[model samples]
Target: MQFLPVVQRIVADRWPWPRSFPRSLSMVRSLVLGVMSLFGSVAVAADWPGFRGTGDSVATGQYPTKWTATEGIAWTVNLPGYGQSAPVIWGGTVYVTAVDGAQREKGFVLALDAKTGKEQWRHALEPTQKAKWSETVSRAAPTPCADADGVYCFFEGGNLLALTHAGKVRWERSLVRDYGEFQGGHGVGSSPAQTADTLFILIDDRGPSYLLAVEKQTGKTRWKTDREARGGWSSPVVATRNGKPEIIASSAGTIIGYAADSGKPLWKLDNVVGNTIPSASVSGDRILFGGGTSRSKDAPPMGAKGNGCLRLIDADGKPGYESVWSAKLGISNYATPLAYQQVAYFVNQVGIVTAHDLQSGQELFAERIDGPCWASMIGAGDYVYFFGKDGTTSVLKAGKEFEQIASNPLWAAKSKPKSAGNESRPGAGSEYGAGETVYGVAAADGAFFVRTGTRLFRIGQ
Candidate 1:
């Protein structure tokens, strides 16, 4: 008779039927506990997680601004192979990718002690067929994405892999096989983004380009949408508009927004230049996008043919969207535009930096700073660091006008030109005038991690 009251309470609580009641209840409880554990892990510390630091595209940690090879260097470990991907710092580990000499593709999600740069564990993915079209210096440029659960790395050959924090393989998927061919001359280079339970990637190649969402825990496809435009190399960023998160992506000729859960296209802005390589940066509700001409010949007239423009897309609209204003002056060829406070800065490969008013698409200041920039700009407390191809690093003030702080040189001692096929053939002749040849830069823990030709340097004060 005493048990009757408990049974009644269970019935009133709408518990499942007795046919499988107890077993099902225990399963449900297990799931709930698992989810809680995952949440607890993610809350431990603030990790980089993805390509552009957090989803906001701002690298805001206690990073240092001024340093030399010996000044602020924390620890520099020689990477086993070579990679052009930026190092993704998570919790206490730094994950990066690399390739072997035989072109037998290998990926490494390295866990480095956050403080001392000590090797924690190196998780290697199954070897893949190397991409022939990819430049030797630009092999597998896709950066790793990590959270509390695991770190995800994408290869140029279309392999998506997941590794646990302790160097265990979680799950892996081949994009080229499951999805389709990525048709770019350089192969797939865009990094994947992670939300609550989804891993989103922009697979824009020559074939049918698409934005794919996979279950973060199991590597299962959640939803994949074939993008309307052709594929480019820019990664996608999650934006919050009207209290809702939207995955904002720029492809060949359009910038689009899709629901984070479902793969539905929420809104799109056409007439955008195709082959865009810069990721979208969000400042409040306005999304800033700019790029150069798709065709190589059109490079001469960048903004003239409408190939480059700074577009401000209003993310508050219902099923549609409108551009607040667009200007031709703020277009970037390869580097993504950086927005700090109210000013958005744009820099092209040819070394032109333009400052624009975020509210109004007005060009506040435009000046030619340096030439041939391939690396993305990183803004620390008060300085914007620009690494040029000629091995020169220029430090400038982040303001309306150009203010050069310091110009440092990165000269390699070797002068032999090494062939791509044979590492011993020779070095690249001279490094004094080779520009910076920098690919990516990240700021964290008060030190700047700069990825040069074959080394990762910790530069800062």
Candidate 2:
């Protein structure tokens, strides 16, 4: 009976309890020392802070490399509206964007429990102007960036708002009123990035474009620099070389870097064209970017069309920068390539997955999946998770050879999709959305979050 009470005290001491709760001295120390063993598998080493995880989109925690709709799914929740912006995870919370209502003007920012997929807070944003959303340009297409204090979201029609973790609005800004109309065939997809105290935003479109850095708390402009980039949906990334800040972006036929502190031009690589959709991924000093038209209709060769490159950035504030390698081997139009295992894996619009050597730019191997991919790939360690437009998630080994581990379908089993077609083969149509579409994906908090038209799924143990 004495040992029984002591055991009970130990169990109670394992977690926080009221003052009246008893604790055994040895038991508390034992439980405290075993913290990592108790929760290591369920913990995320770092936050998925922005459009891409920590700006570059590479993950360190163990995420699910394979899962199906009715198989390894942890939880699923319906969203207010449809979007293509990937989810961002911070601590125990996951944040995503959407637009509600018939007019589709109701922009919303949602906070959910990262582990349970439970709804935490839903903050709806008021748009400055009525949004005109299309299949190509989604209303809530730009993924939000989050920090320790707040989450910042930008919607189509240039509506921007920052919300605290508890769903309180901190500040709001209008990109449309501040910068003018977003004139283009498609709308904005430039998500926000952050330095220590400044938030960096790049708006590159047919209308006036600029890169603006704003103070985090008040949303006041720190620096505003004009940009010549027209019609790009890629998000900006923040990195540092030799303790200085560099905000890098790939858009409008160039890979440009800006001084994060003063919003001044640091360097640029011109002659890069057709890379507009997916945000560039980074690995240490190198940035990998790729995108282009997958379907040109009846029109044939418009010169040699290929949009992909691996460019190394000079982090030391040096003026010179060079491409580590350039090739048409692994160029993705919408889906962003994931850099893993020292190779950049690019998935073209029609499901052509290519892995190119990061150091040499030589084509390693290519494979065809069951569908086209709209969302960018996210990697954790040796495994990469690829989301297809038809709600399929293909798990692959991040190796030189093409090795597919699993082909997991996302939609309900009742929904049937045709076998993936070959883009190079004749009589094949590579149109997108073959079934229920999966638009965005993220990996954090020991789980993978997938975004469908109107739902989000958390996949892990």
Candidate 3:
């Protein structure tokens, strides 16, 4: 056999050394194997690094199916202030933002030991200025996004911040100063999306609203695009076209696609109507966009009063463009449409759930779900969970046909007596309500973390 330099040398050296004795390099070999196994374990239990768990809008984990205030609660902690943002879990920490009681716009990004539900750290940020037009209970509604290195938060008043896993401030920026001001009745509700290298924000403000990309490592502005504002609160999502990724966003007037790397507008569909708050969901090559009543000016005179359409954009061209079909389903303004396999599900503010065919805009089935819904529906395996504003969660099968599976109530506990001077504060009318309004629901590690008014409960086993 022709000698292959190193290979032949190694064979000759090993022939006399390993016949009846241990190799000297055996310890080194074991150490190398051990390091690889440790890396594999870390990769397996990946964190929910950002909003909607990995930007595909899929909450993946062995999340709990049935839960109540008392039952299936892994742990319950009384949050310091109030917020509507969902709890973001990363590694072993849980992070959320809230506005405290002194009329101060505070950011409470808490770190809880994911295993024991114990408090780790509470990082607070005093706002430069209090957020405007925020209802007492609805302030700080934007959720936090976390990665292995740090957690990020976006305040309603346009403050964006990054913190280390150990609770240290990494960087901060203000969207209003950097970009412009938002125009919604409520402030910014769109959560930021984090990718491997950049953090994306959908700033649909009143003046010069656009999609922005920032460097995740240093919080520096990477690229910004000033696109037409269709008046939306929907979060931007990353979708792949061909082999490249695109940032897809839906607003009141159009559904546009931008290059994720450069923030360039690729295509636009102007068939969508009304102010949009629902994020688009992608299934295979077809992207689904829905929700929003026609802006007060564009409302139809007859039939259902809202404008809803299921547009299928073909993702196989340089600038693929088309609206497969459009429908007049009156969906809720804030409820995002969810895609499950072949069918698409939508829940409106008035409590109606509609299922539509993915390919065509034909309605498959429609049914009325109890209570008004502001939180988007989440699909967990075979069941789609709908959390209503009135604190009732309705579970249904994810199918072309309608089916109500279970309805769990989170009614408030007995009202506590108010202190003597507490009644004089401004906007304290509903201080002691009878129901826990479910604003956002997130599933992770076999548990459903639900945010009511001031409490965050872990549901399911």
List TM-scores for all candidates, in order: 0.79, 0.81, 0.80
Q: Where is the poorest 10-residue window by lDDT in model 2?
A: 1-10
lDDT winner: 2
Evaluated at residue 268, the lDDT of candidate 1 is 70
Write the residue-wise lDDT of candidate 2 on 148-218 in tens digits. Answer: 77788877657777788899999998978887877754556667876656777788877788898887788
Specify the poorest-scoring 10-residue window by lDDT in model 3: 1-10
Clashing pairs in 3: 62-446, 63-446, 332-348, 332-349
lDDT of 3 by residue, 1-461 (tens): 00011111111100011112334577446534433332222222335555565554456545555555455556655677767777778776777677775554576778776655677888787765464433422366777777666888888667888899898999998876776666553456677765656778887746667888988778898999987654456777766544456777876557788887899888876656543566766554466676555545565444332334433245654666555555556364566667665667777656888887765767898788876666667776777888777767888877777888788755435464254221122222223336456667666676666676566666664
Give lDDT: candidate 3, residue 362: 78
Residue 220 local lDDT, model 2: 77
Q: Cα RMSDs of all predictions?
A: 14.6, 14.8, 15.6
Off by over 4 Å in 1: 1-46, 127-129, 133-138, 294-317, 410-436
**RMSD, candidate 2, Å:** 14.8
Name the candidate, 2 or 3, with the larger TM-score value. 2
Ranking under TM-score, best-scoring first? 2, 3, 1
Q: On residues 140-203, what C-alpha lDDT tens digit does candidate 1 reach at each position?
A: 5777777778788788767888888888888888887886666665556677766667778887
Q: Give candidate 3's error at residue 305 in angstroms.
A: 13
